[model samples]
Target chain A: MTDRYKYMEDLLNRFFSGETSNEEERELYRFFAGEDIPAHLRRYKPVFSYFESGLEKELNLLTGEPAEAAEPFRRAMPKRRIRIAAGMAALALILSVAALLFLRKANAFDPYEGSYIVRSGVRITDTSLIRPEIEATIQKALQQEERANRLLLSLSASNPETRIEQIQRRINRQNEEIINRFPNEMKESIRRIIENK
Target chain B: MKTRHLIAAAILLITGSLSANLPAQETLKALVKKCESMDNVNTSVVRNRNKQTKKLEKEIISLNFSNNQALVNEFIAAFEKDKLMADKEIEGKNNGKKTLFYRFGDTSYSFSQLNEGSASVSVIQKDEYEYEE
Candidate 1:
């Protein structure tokens, strides 16, 4: 037990324990590659001496022969992680701003951005509901109106004499109402009609 | 490939969810055109039912809009003068509803100004008269 503890203690004292990084692990390899060991362990003399010759390798910290130099990935990884995190954060901020702008424009609060104001009390009609696409709606409404008028015309043609008499009576009543409704200057149209009749 | 398809489906779902609400929103040009085509009085239909009979009551209504400030003020002046004339003619006879003459396409429409910007006019005939029902 004492021998095991002593061996572990010496290994830890030279940074060959669990705490050894890539650099320190390689240092341990170099330190062990020797012929001369300590007096207590003279049977492993060649192993210790081989490591001592390579002690010059420990001094060459900048050169790359094996684990003599620092790891390239370890040196560069932190900066790359920081740069990627920064890019993600910037992207998130941009997306948030775009979302805010889209919400404001969508709510019809801005005139510069496309938005429609609705009539306050009017119940929305299906025909006039498509405010953004008014052309299509107007065309559809005009077609429907034309169809209704054509139906009316067909009905009038079917009962020509009675329909004409009824129309004449409605017109005469409307003319009387107009003549009673207006003043001298406003009644000129009715005067011309009466004279022509 | 399955993961890619799932991601694409999720994107489509999100966009479709956002776009579904588009129909409820209105545009600016439609508002301006409607404002332009407004009149001083328009008919509104009122439907009432008691037991087996459904009745329609036609009430004259006045129209006022923010854009027609000048016309509204003119109507107010005309209303005040008519009220003064009515007070002189009927001295003690006062009815809650009063009629003043309004013109529409060479026709006289009986109406009364409700306020500075609003007027009341007879709009629609009864859909079914109560006596007939």
Candidate 2:
């Protein structure tokens, strides 16, 4: 065999083994790109021909025709992927909003399904427990006012009705303050109690 | 002698009726005291005052009797009297167990009988009134 063919065989072995340097591969490509090959080396001609065609793509870029035609199809793939991604995001947002609205509507029917504070600052779902506590608050306020009334009667020689009216006003003020301190559910229950009375 | 016997019978009748109408407050307090003094009975009372409002906000008494069914039965019987006089006894569930609640005008008492002869009672008295110190 010729020394040129022996050199090509060494380069092909290096290339297959991934040990060929860029300069050595380029030397191989240049040697094979020239015509007049031996019959034994004909099988390797297609590989070097592929390299020659790749190098000739610079000429195609100078013409700027075929690359432009391939550009639209390459760009269309990314645009289609973007549209599909945007549609999935919008669907997820719609589903989240629908779930939130459904949960809010369900909670509105039983507003106290979760725990909330009563006037006594105790968190409980049962309003029956709160009713007795509210009554206790009012009764204690009345009892204190009654003690004050007794003192007022003994200490001051004022009219009983005037002192009683003042005590009643004080009690009313205290009761209003207490009811306002309660949470919404307890306030509703107290309002119902007052309306019934 | 016959007149004396009649007078004694009338006196006994009056006292019996009066005892029949005895207020539940006295009985409940007595039962709580008795249970608190027994062995293996844990009694605790928590008193809280609201600083801003200057009110005695809460007074809660809790009692736990462990392996003391006899004391629990006595206390239950005594509390049954109060339950009879309560305006309403609201049945409730706590931790998947039945709870009997007796609500007076201003105070509420809840009782639960647990497994293994353990029982608990809680007396909650909450009031919002600012008293002179």
Candidate 3:
């Protein structure tokens, strides 16, 4: 028994130094699995037991047995995939929002935003204060244009001839009324004189 | 996959920039901007709104310049190429005032030179107009 303990101690030292072979490591595991370990060396049993359980799980996975060997890998792969997907989604969302704001600002069409008024070497750009003056100026301009249009219509080629004819008819009608009001004998004389007969 | 996402983002940015880079034509609004920077000129603009909807329906721009025959002539020369609806060179009844009127699309422009060496230009823009014979 003392010889066995001495050998076990030597194997433990080699394992710590990473010089023990696989067979010797397996033997240490088997020794720790038994309850006959000396009290002084029993403190190292848990470490060998943990390594033995881990190796068994790895072997079970290699043999296609259902075990915890694939749990860490399964959990790790999805977490990485989710992180990548989330990053892309956030990037797309930021780009979309920025584009929307830029387009809206670029396309907002207000032609009169920079309208202003200059008077007597002074410039007035406040829309609210100058709006009434602007409206009045427009009204005056429209009125002036309307007057010009009316004048042009009156001066058109066909208007003066029609006006002359209407005026001639009215004058003849007035002369006839005046003759009828005069004495019957004098009416003929007056008509002859007016016609320059 | 990452390269594809980056390419799509680049395409979207390029499209947006291209749309923003479209050329703008010369309009009355552009003329108003020019007039704003000119010396000895008075410029005014009025936006007409619909009473019911409270939305902008039309715009009116007016410019007045005193003793600025050069500017008046410049405007006359520029507008002469456009379709003129009325051209009264000399109105003897109104002290020889010259008036020119032009209509294009839904906009109308009038340029007038008064006897006192004052020139006025008026622009009226509407959403639409009824067709006249």
Q: Which candidate leads in DockQ? A: 3
Candidate 2 residue-wise lDDT, B33-116, digit = tens: 666555566554444455555456666666666687776667667666455445335454557544566554456666777855
**DockQ pick, better of 2 and 3:** 3
How should the candidates be ordered by TM-score, best one leading? 3, 2, 1
Instruction: Report lDDT (CA) for all predictions.
Output: 0.40, 0.59, 0.67
TM-score of each: 0.26, 0.31, 0.40
What tens digits encode model 3's per-residue C-alpha lDDT throughout A1-197?
A: 99999999999999999999999999999999999999999999998997889777788889998777588899999999999999999999999999999999757544345556777657887777786786687678678657645655666544444656646654554444444444688778656645545
User: Model 3 Cα displacement at A160 (Å)?
Assistant: 15
DockQ, each predicted model = 0.02, 0.02, 0.13
lDDT of 3 by residue, B8-106 (tens): 456445544544422121233355567766777877777766655556777777888888777766666655533221213213324567676655445
Two-way lDDT contest, 1 vs 3, winner? 3
The C-alpha stretches of model 1 lying farther than 4 A from their native spots are A1-58, A61-70, A100-197, B1-111, B114-133
Best-to-worst DockQ order: 3, 1, 2
Kindly report which residue pairs in candidate 3 clash with one another. none
- Residue pairs with backbone overlap in model 2: none
* Residue-level lDDT tens digits of model 2 in A3-93: 8788788888888798999899888777777776777777777877776675456567787747446778999999999999999999999
The DockQ-based CAPRI class assigned to model 2 is: incorrect
Off by over 4 Å in 2: A1-197, B1-23, B91-98, B128-133
- Shift of residue A102 alpha carbon in model 3, Å: 26
